[model samples]
Target: MRKRAKKHNYTVIIERIREMVRENGLQPGDRLPPERVLAAAFHVSRGSLRQALQALAERHIVESRQGQGTYLLADFDSVLPGDAILEKVSEHDNVLHDIFEFRRIIEPEIAALAAQRANVATLNQLKVLVYDQQRALFNNNEVDQFDTQFHQLLVAMTGNSVIAQVMQAIQAIVDTSRAPWLQSRKRRQMSIEGHLRIIDALEKKESDGARRAMQQHLAAVEQFIFDNQ
Candidate 1:
């Protein structure tokens, strides 16, 4: 009975922490209050609070970086078990087809919205990403990080938190599935060209053009994956 009561208290504390996060409007990359502060605020023992935090961490609700404190992840789905989409793709043997189908349904619209809403700061940030991608290519380095950031930034520029969260989740799945295909230089160069077109449309604030560019880009990526496979 005592163990049951303790478990119940722990669950309650976890929910309360979630409520605190929402009430605080804490976005991704935001740091939580110090351990002592959070424990005191929740009126829970430090041990109890630590247990709750560990649960959240396991679920990717929060991440603790050594010497940097706990920070919320941009994608809450990051901690989803292997049985999620990643496993589905692996078991089905049509990973690229599945991922590109999802991108076709979602990313073009994301690009259109980003073109409509992106500010100068966002545009500049995207330009920097493009430059970084090009630099990586020239240096014969991997382009996966910049490519992922480029897409994520587009989703975020849409100014819709719900869409941003959904895309973040989808992207986590895409990242795991694209690992093998991203190793090809031909594919990497083609991706760089596609990114340039998308950036050009966004810079001009042409929503339709941005949408078309993204569609064409994804089509090319789909073809590359199909041919290589």
Candidate 2:
């Protein structure tokens, strides 16, 4: 009974920390409560309290920056969603498909521009992005932060700040979608393979090939989107 009670106590403490974070409107860069203070307030050992924080971090609700402190993650939930509307908002929506359409127009141009102007370092960065993504997908880390870097680096190669900004505006939706889209058996097998073809075209300075490869890749995205429709 004592052990069970202790478990319940820690769970309650974790919930309290979550509430405090929301109450303060904390963001990704915002520091969380210091360990000693929070543990003291909860009348719990630092070890148990850290475990609770770890749980929250895994859910992307918080983050810890080295030498700084634990931070409240900037995320969808930080938008001040009321509890009743939260679950409803998570369901699929058409906004993401629209973003994909936007990508269709922009991604090919970005690829073409990248072919025309990307320096050796930038082209190699694209290669690394594809390779790193392949590794992540194979390692089952595809749903992690690597997906963001993969797409972002692809666009970054174009050196178009405005295009990058447009992409960043819809970043959350794109990041959220990558896992479910990639989870399709077809993509799980060969998504990286297609991306590599694009990288190869870009590296070879083949503008037309890069354009075609990018178009084909995003065409896959379009098919995925409307297929769900």
Candidate that scores best on lDDT: 1
Query: Which parts of model 1 have CA positions greater than 4 angstroms off?
Result: 1-92
Please report the TM-score between candidate 1 and the true structure: 0.59
Per-residue accuracy of model 2 over 149-169 as CA lDDT, tens digit each: 656877887778998898888
Cα deviation of 220, candidate 2, in Å: 1.6
| TM-score per candidate | 0.59, 0.52
Report how far residue 206 has shifted in candidate 2, in Å: 2.2
Alpha-carbon RMSD of each model? 16.4, 12.7
Q: What's the lDDT for candidate 1?
A: 0.74
TM-score of 2: 0.52
Instruction: Give the lDDT of residue 89 in candidate 1.
Output: 27
What is the clash tally of candidate 1?
Answer: 0
Q: What lDDT does each candidate get?
A: 0.74, 0.64
Model 2 vs truth, CA RMSD: 12.7
**Best-fitting candidate, measured by TM-score?**
1
